[model samples]
Target: MTKEANAAYDSSWTFIFAWLLLGISLLISGVRDLYDPAASAWTTWLGFISSAVFLLMAVNGMRLRRRRRESAEPAGAAS
Candidate 1:
């Protein structure tokens, strides 16, 4: 694959991995909270922050992939 295709593939994989990680982390946090109702608020807040970061990373990766795809199209193509 060309450099642009490789970059797009990387970005897509990163986004998928980030989303998977975020989902797993959230599941663990939920289970932890259920197991211990008195779990520190900080722990919950940290999970929230981590998930947000992962979500942002995934979104940015998707945007990057989309841009790469658009740029790879022929210049004379209709908008």
Candidate 2:
């Protein structure tokens, strides 16, 4: 693939990875909470916040990918 294609592919993969990481973190936090409901509450909250950050990163990555694709297109193309 060309450089632009590679960049797009990488961005897409990054978004997927961010989502996967967030999901895994949440899952672990949930399991921990189940094992120690009271003590693990803080841990769960931290995990939730981390997941939110990852979600935001994924959204930003998607936006960057979209911008890259738009810039790669010809100027005469419709918006």
Candidate 3:
């Protein structure tokens, strides 16, 4: 990959990883709530919001990766 492509790839993975981390954090929160059984309403709403944000980020990252690959196809085939 050229420098620009490499930078794009890295940024795409960064978004994916950030969302993944949020998901894992939410999972951990769920587990804690399960063990304690004293979770608050705020906690529940926060979890839902986090999930929505993660989904959005994941979809955006996927779109970005798809665009990058599709754009590279012609250049790759020509070479």
Candidate 4:
């Protein structure tokens, strides 16, 4: 990989991991809220929805990384 592409790939991984982390935390919060006496139903729903969105973002990032890697490869390298 070129220097710039390598840098971008590394940064993309960083973002992907960040998204995954956020998703996990939010999912845990949502589940916890479900069992907490004082937690509002709306708060729980919001946490779950937000977690789904973040997890989707992480999945998209992974797809983008695959595309980037494929494009970076030489034309004849695939077969």
lDDT (C-alpha, whole model) for all candidates: 0.71, 0.72, 0.67, 0.66
- Please give the RMSD of candidate 1 to the true structure: 2.8
TM-score list, all predictions: 0.60, 0.63, 0.47, 0.53
lDDT of 4: 0.66
Q: Per-residue lDDT for 1-79 in model 1, tens only? A: 9876776677667667666766766777678778885774556576567767766766787787778778878988945
Q: Candidate 2, residues 1-79: lDDT per residue as tens digits?
A: 9866776677677667667766776787788878887776776677677767766765776677678888878999965
Q: Give every collision pair in model 1.
A: none
User: What is the full ranking by lDDT, best candidate first?
Assistant: 2, 1, 3, 4
The worst-scoring run of ten residues by lDDT in candidate 1 lies at: 39-48
RMSD of each: 2.8, 2.6, 4.5, 4.6
Question: Would you give me the overall lDDT of model 1?
Answer: 0.71
Candidate of highest lDDT:
2
- Give the true-structure RMSD of model 4: 4.6
Cα misplacement distance, residue 79 of candidate 3 (Å): 29
- lDDT by residue for model 4 (1-79), tens: 9855665676567567666665666676667667883665555566566656655665676677678888989999999
Model 2: lDDT of residue 41: 71
lDDT per residue for candidate 3 within 1-79, as digits (tens), equals: 8855665666667667657766776776778777775764456667667766666665676677677777878765856
**In candidate 2, how many Å is residue 4 off?**
3.9
Residue 10's lDDT within candidate 3 is 68
